[model samples]
Every structure is written in structure tokens, then in C-alpha cells.
Target: MHRVGLTGGIAAGKSTVAARLRRLGAAVIDHDVLAREVVAPGSSGLEAVAEAFGQEVVTVLGELDRAALGAQVFADPMARERLNAIVHPLVTEAAREREAAAVADGSTVVVHDIPLLVETGQAGHFDELVVVDAPPELRVQRLVASRGLTETQAWDRLAAQADDEARIAVADVVLDGSGAVSELEDQVDALWAVWADRHPAGSAR
Candidate 1:
């Protein structure tokens, strides 16, 4: 299996690339989705989070109070690290299970769509590292204009992630995300053409 690590900063259009790849044939394991699942109400992941961040981070309905935790972590580096410590391992285990399933199902390309791929020191784990590049200023503008985030909030989120330089330094493939959606899709299609040719049966369609 070709294990590809896909990552980009906030608003960098990484999702667009991942979706296109998914349509082409790659099985994508989205870490953000796993992050939420691992910490679901009754799971041990949630228990670990509650133990570390306190019960206030969990709501009356036994659900994670995401907003509360977001506020805490965004404002304090220590709190963010504590949360990462509690969540990252669980997410990794879940991701491994999903990857195993994908491989067993005869997937030739398995993409791990991880936002913090570089920050978590996972660049070496993949057969290829795909980083969707976009200027931070553009991303900040996008976050404010489309996501309803205040400029300060957008910048804060950007500040919390791995820098562009670090991600670029380790990337095996770089997709430009500073263009239109169609352009990005074209790039994904080009990559998929190669991947499909590599293992023809991987493309079921």
C-alpha cells in the first residue's frame, strides 16, 4: 500500500485534495474525524480527557464540551499539550485499525488526512508526504471571510499549528492551494492518474 500523509494548514484546501483523491480510489483516514470519535462520550478517551482537563470539559448529556475545551487549549499551550497527550495516542490506534481495514480491502493508496502531520512527527511514517501549500495570510483571510472567525481567532489557530516551512521541508509532494477549486482538483487528478497506473486494480471504477 502507498501510505500517503496529507496535510496543510487551516483553510489550505487540504479537504479538497483529499476528497478528490477519495473519488479517484484512495481510502482516506481523516484524523480530525478520528479525533472526535476517540473522545466520544462514553469512551476511555473521553475519560482520559476529563481526568486531565477536568469534568467541566464534558457536558451534562455526556458529550464533550468542545467549545469549552477549545477555549482552554487555544489560550494555554500547556492545556493544549495536555489535550494532545490524551487524544493523540487514541487517534493513532484508531487510525491504524482503519488503515489495516483499508489494506485488507485491497486499497493500493491509503491517505491519512492529518492536519498536524508534521507537528506530530509523522513525516517519516508515510511513503509519501503531500502538503497542500497556501500562504498563511491567504488562509487567515479565508478563515475570517468564510468561517466567521474573527481575525484574532484565525491568527491564533494558525499560530497553534505547524509552520509552513516545517511542513514544506519534509514534503515529498506539494499541491498548490492558492488557486481555484477546479485547479486543485486538476492537480489531484494528475496525482491519481499516476497512483492508478501503479496498481490498476486499486481503481475499482
Candidate 2:
């Protein structure tokens, strides 16, 4: 299977593009979904996380209290790193398992929708790295509106990411997300064609 890593800055419409790829018949493994799954209620991941961050990070119902955990980690670089150290490997492992299953099922192309693909320096693992591109201001605006983050909070999160130039520099495919949704759709449709041409019948989309 052709492993494509799809990534973008926060609020850059990565999920929208990923969903479109799925609708077009590509097998997509959403890293965010796998991130949640790895830490679900009684999983070993949750146990490790609670051990690392204390039980306060877990809800009464035993699921991770994401908001509380975010609050603790986002403001502190060390805390964020600590959390990621425990979480990222588990998420990555689960994602690999999912990808292997898709490949076994005869998928021709498998896309991993990952937000921190560049930040983690894992882009080298993929056959293609597709980045959803948008201006920083647009990213901030989208984050504020969609995620309810304050301007300062949005900037802080953006500050934590590699700059747009850095991200675009490494992209094998750049999907411009600053324009209308229809524009993004065009990019994805064109990308689907390219993938089909490159992989022939082995790929799903």
C-alpha cells in the first residue's frame, strides 16, 4: 500500500480533506481517532497516562478528561512533552496496526491523517506527505471560531507549530485550504486521480 501522510497546522482543515478522501474510497486512518482509542477507558494506554499525570486526568466514568488534561499540558512545555511521550508512541503503534490491516485487506492507498507529522519528524516514513496549506492568520481565525480558543490561546498554539514555509517545504502535495471548500474539493479530486494513476488497481482511491 502507498502510505500517504496527510498533515496540516491546527485548524487548517485537515479533517475536512481527510473526510473527502474517505468519501472518494481511500482507506484513511485518522490519527486523532486512534489517539482517542489508544487511551480509551480501560486500555493500557489510559493506565500509563493516569500513572504519568495522576488520576486527575481521568474522568469519574474512567475516560480521559481531555479538557482538564489539555489545560494542564498546553501551558507547560514540559508537561506537554511528558504527555506526548506517553501518548504518541501508543498512537503511532495503533496507527501502524490499522495500516497493516488495511494493507492486508488489499488497500492500494492508505492515508494517515496526522496533525503532528512534521513536529514529530515522522514524515520520512510515508511515501508521500500532503500538507493542507493556509495562512497563519486564517489558521488562527479558524481555531478561534471552531475550537473556541481565545486569540492569545490560538497564537500560543500556532507558535508551537513549525512555520508554514517549513511545512510546505516538505510537502509532496500541497492542498490549499485557504480558499473555499469547493477549492479544497478540487485539490482532493485531482490528488485522487494522481494516486490512482500512480498506484493503479492496488490502491483503494
- List where candidate 1 sits over 4 angstroms from the true fold: none
Relative to the unseen true structure, what is the C-alpha lDDT of residue 93 in candidate 2, on a scale of 0 to 100? Answer: 92
Q: At residue 31, what lDDT does model 2 achieve?
A: 90
- Give the range of the ten consecutive residues with the poorest summed lDDT in model 1: 196-205
lDDT of 2 by residue, 72-119 (tens): 877788887888888899999999899888878877789999988887
Q: For each candidate, what is the lDDT? A: 0.92, 0.88
- Candidate 1, 58-152: lDDT as tens digits: 99999999988999998788888888888999999999999999988888789999998898888999988999999999999999999899999
lDDT of 1: 0.92
Best by TM-score: 1
